[model samples]
Target: MSNLTIVLIILVIYMALMVLIGLQGRKHSSNMQDFLTAGKQGTLLLVTGSYMGSHIGNGIVVGGAEYGATYGIGGMWYGVGAAISFYLFAIFMARVVYRNNYVTLSDLLEQRYGDKMTSIAVALLNAVSNIAVMAGQIMAGERLFQYIGLNPLAGAIATTTIVIIYSSLSGLWGVMMTDVIQVTVIVISVIATMIFIATQGGFSIMAQNLPATSFEMIPFDGETFIMMLGPTALFGLVSSTGFQRTVSCKKEKTAILAPVLGASLILLFVPLPVMIGMYGKALWPDAASGTIIFQVLFEAMPPLLAGLLIASICAAVMSTSDGILVTVTANIVSDIYHKHINPDADEKSLGRLSRISSVVIGIFALIIALQFSSLISLLSLSYTLITAGGLVMIVGAIFWKKATRQGALASFIAGVACVVINKMGVSLPYASVFPLIPSFLAYVIVSLMTQNKNAAAA
Candidate 1:
């Protein structure tokens, strides 16, 4: 059989297996508590695995090559940002979030300010961010399909459908369990490529072929590095999936260690794809930026192995999508629908809504994937909006007891407004993070005023 045929066969089998696993996860997911977080029973291995799955997503495994191909060594920013996020969260957030017994970020923020409307607003914004991230993940399957001579749209539809089905059926436990399998495939793909490259002369040959500038950590400028890194760092801080991973852990030590260990693994694993993409640039010189690494890997692997790797790429990318999908679903069901829209929603009704929301969110994300083909760029836009508008509020909620609902709400408005304005026509350094200035100021100023007013009234 042709390689494409073999890959098609393997993909069919692999995707079926994923759906089966989700079915198994459904057994554990009887209600929102189990569906959303596996009932806080995640062990260290599962949490860390899911964290790795969520963070690595399309941003690194596939998009990393595209980024590294375009930015050279500077592509290291994503991994650096992730490592920083994990370390910071471990020290500042892990325990706090766990102690409070929060499910979504809105829950965490709501306690600080005591506003149901603010909770609803947070849920909506998070929905936007989560859906955008899901779109980025879905694009990975489009990339793989394009590589294999299939219709890109078909690939996108297929991937989105599978994720919606599986994530809806399985929930958090299923996501973590399937994550273990997907992560294994990622390791094999990376190690195999590294070994293949080493056999063919390794880093020495690659360095000689590439320009010296490719070795620099900051390949372009400080601003671009910050632009690339800052959004990820802030998103890491505020990410719903990251929050889910933390709160999923039952033990205090496990919660802390999972993200830390996962970050360490990410730090080590991220460089391989950057180097691989660089090597692709050194050789092909004119290959597409977003697909250089995949091409390189496919060229090195046998037909069967290549098929497996491609399937895994789909799994890896969708692995990220399901988490984002689940986050948005939770926002709709737990944060908005159950909490605000229908306070009387029983666990059974909420459970049905959760599944339906997953389907709706996945469809919306699929529409986005159809419009944009740049995986990393799409992800950047998602993070940019969230970082600009939501990051400040989350930080204030955690640190400043005086952070009132008015301040949190203002920060969301100003930060999001600034991002839209910046995107329209403004050209600025660190465009992704630039809006944070207005966001932070609004959050702090409005907060102080509101705090004083409330204090006086008391």
Candidate 2:
């Protein structure tokens, strides 16, 4: 078969397998817990694979490669930061979250704060932010199809339909299982592509050809460096997704190992695409840096190998979109539907609602993905929303015995409001500081003040 034909075949087979897995997972997921958290029976390897695969999606895959071209040796810090975030999760947050028995982060928050208002708000924003992420995945898949001389929109629609159909059927089990397969394909392909490029010129030639800024540790302005490393790290560590992964793990060791292993692999290879892009830039300076990966594989590499590499990129996007679909649906069904509308709803009814929610959320995300442009910008915004409300509420629940419902309520409202206002560009110019800082402070102050009142009454 031709290279294009090979790629098309791989995608068809892979997508077909995912749909089958989705159908099979339904057997295991007969209840809300089964659908949302796999009956809390996720094994160590399962947790590791799912968390690692989901976090290192298409953006990290292709985007890391793009950064490798520009950021040089230092750009690997992105994965480095991510690894650190997971490490912190394993040490402090994972066990606590798991012990709490909350299905979603919003579920935990609502219980502590005694408020549904913030949970409602969080569910809405989580769905919206996740759509932003799904859109980027769609865009990446589209770019790949474009290189093969197919319509970008058609590629996007096809990819989205497959993901949504499977996700609607399988829920979290399907997402986690499929992620392992996707991550394997992505890693193997990335390594193969990198080795090929390295052999063509070696690091010496690549370094000699690429610009100096591409290799520097602190590529951006001094302020940008601090912003990226400081609050960004905190935001990532404390967010709902990170906590959920930690809580989802079968054991603490699994939580620790998966992220470390995944992060290490990502750090080792993600820069390869950038190096490829750098080489492409040297060869075709006018080529858009964003398009460098697709352009290089299509034009430089032999057809058979290029098809394999492109399949890897598709794996990256699908792995992530499915996981996010599961997470968002869990929040809606557990935190919104079951919690407020019908606490006594049967497991069968909740399971059916979860499947329905998955499809509804998938469509909404596809629509938004069609509209957005920048992947990193949307990622930053989503993290901000989660950190602002989610981080503080989770921390308070675990650490502070004195943290009252009133205090939790205040923190939830103020943190979310501040995050939204900051994100909407309503604050002073350059006042768009990371939301975690202010949200953390509000949580601390409110909790302390309320604790003192309770003590006085005693």
Number of backbone collisions per candidate? 0, 6
Give all TM-scores, in the order shown.
0.96, 0.88
Error of 1 at 167 (Å): 0.8
Candidate 1 segments whose C-alpha is farther than 4 A from its true place: 202-205, 456-458
lDDT of each: 0.81, 0.66
* Candidate 2 clash pair list: 65-274, 69-274, 70-214, 71-214, 72-214, 135-369
The ten-residue window of minimal lDDT in model 2 covers: 428-437
Candidate 1 per-residue lDDT, tens place, 1-458, comes to 77667877897898788878878887767777788887677898888888778767577777777877887777878877876777777877888888787788899877877788777887898899889889988888887778767798898998898888778778888888888788878777777877777778867777887787788888787777776687877777787887787778889899889889888888988887787788788778888987786687566556677677777778877767877788899898889887778999788788788778888898899998888867777777888887787888888888888788889889999989987887788776578888888888998899888877878766
Model 1 scores a C-alpha lDDT of 0.81
Task: Output the lDDT of residue 453, model 1.
Answer: 83
Cα error, candidate 1, residue 154 (Å)? 0.7
